[model samples]
Target: MTLTALFNKSIIVSGISFLLYFSSFLSPGNATSNNARLTSKDRVTTASPAVLVFSKTNGYRHKSIEAGKAAFTKMAADKNFTVEFTEDSTQFNTENLKRFKAVVFLNTTGNVLGDQEQAAFEKFIQAGGGYVGIHSATDCEYNWEWYGKLAGAYFLNHPGPKNVLNGKFYVVDKDHPTTKGMPAEFERSDEFYSFKNINPDINVLIKIDEKSYAGGKNGDNHPMSWYHDYDGGRAFYTAMGHTDESFVEPLFLNHVYAGLQYAIGK
Candidate 1:
């Protein structure tokens, strides 16, 4: 070959080698990429989705709110997800709500969101956002009929003589991710709530054994935790988390995590 042709061939060969080397460097199995991967461990890991914890309440408020928030903040860090806690009603706007994979109502009570805010929230759910209601969240938005169905029930009453009581929890559906690893039967002491306007279609994950406690209103099938797909999004609600200690409980934390996962479409 002529000298000029040979030089051109060498250039082409050098370019091909360079491309191959670059490709290998980008491979996961490569050593140089390993250090780069370690530096970007967060990005290299699973996508860290975010959830918004909204504890707004116009009426009665639970003292566990702060504890729940703290626990959830820790949970977000440990589980590789982002959590933003807020009671501000303005956060309900579509633009703000879009940033969350799920919205968690932690111990919220009474009518919190206004008509416009409620509309935005409804739209958020319809757009495939997730919702997790803890404790008194069922007590909110009683006038908003759509929220009743979304929450699966409205808070009717609890044992008035004592807000906190002892009860035996029965796991009805062990197949659900939230209840999967939990014991079939367990005992817990907390403010158990009675529910009205409960949608019969909801899939109950856990129930309280009324016979184990006094002033049991719901009788044989008192649901403590349940989940269902509502509109275009997922909904999970639990009657627990009334006490500050409940937030620190390992099982309860796991339950919350699992509920979040389900709501986020994981």
Candidate 2:
């Protein structure tokens, strides 16, 4: 063959070989392709559940809401749980809530939802969904009976005009998952809450020692955290997370983390 022709033929053979090799690599049966196969197990780490955070309230406690959001996001990223956050309670419609394994009320307060949305949320919980309430979540839905029952209490009062001091948190049920990694009694600086008509039957996980705070209501039995079963659904609530400082605390974060996981059914 001519030298020029030989060179051209050699170039064509090289090109064809390269294409064949690329095609093989791209095939699903190839080892490289198999390595990329994504599984549900691969997406989540601890078989943790999914959680949705709903914060739809307008008031002076915006900081608390923001802190709650940050905490939920952090947990969602590292744990086996997924999180969806929104300030619109209307998004709690049946279809939207069905996608989440659990729902969280992040420092929400007052009448944030309309009649239809309230009814939908009630139904959602009754259907064996999970719920997690943080901080001022107790101050929410004062007129909704179902919600009050689910939350286990309503905001009756606060000692400080605003949350500005450190308070002691007393663990009522240290054996609970939410308190499993926490100390029996720990003092932290945050806004403490007192509830009205807290359901006595609900499992109380943590309580605030009223003696530690001035002008505190509910006396010495003030509950700081609780969990209960409502209409076939699991519910958790913590009076903590009133400040940005609370979210970053290692011990507090662990408590919130376990609560979120439990509410997600993990």
Local distance difference test values of all predictions, in order? 0.92, 0.80
Candidate 2 pairs with clashing backbones: 166-189
Q: For candidate 1, give the lDDT.
A: 0.92
Instruction: Measure candidate 1: CA RMSD.
Output: 6.2
Every model's TM-score: 0.84, 0.81
Candidate 2: tens digits of C-alpha lDDT, residues 98-215: 8777888888877888998987788888888888888888898888888888889988777656556777787888788788877778888877777897887789888888788775
Best by lDDT: 1
Per-candidate clashes come to: 0, 1
How do the residues 11-71 of candidate 1 rate in per-residue lDDT, one tens digit apiece? 9999999999899977877876688677688565546798999998789878899999999
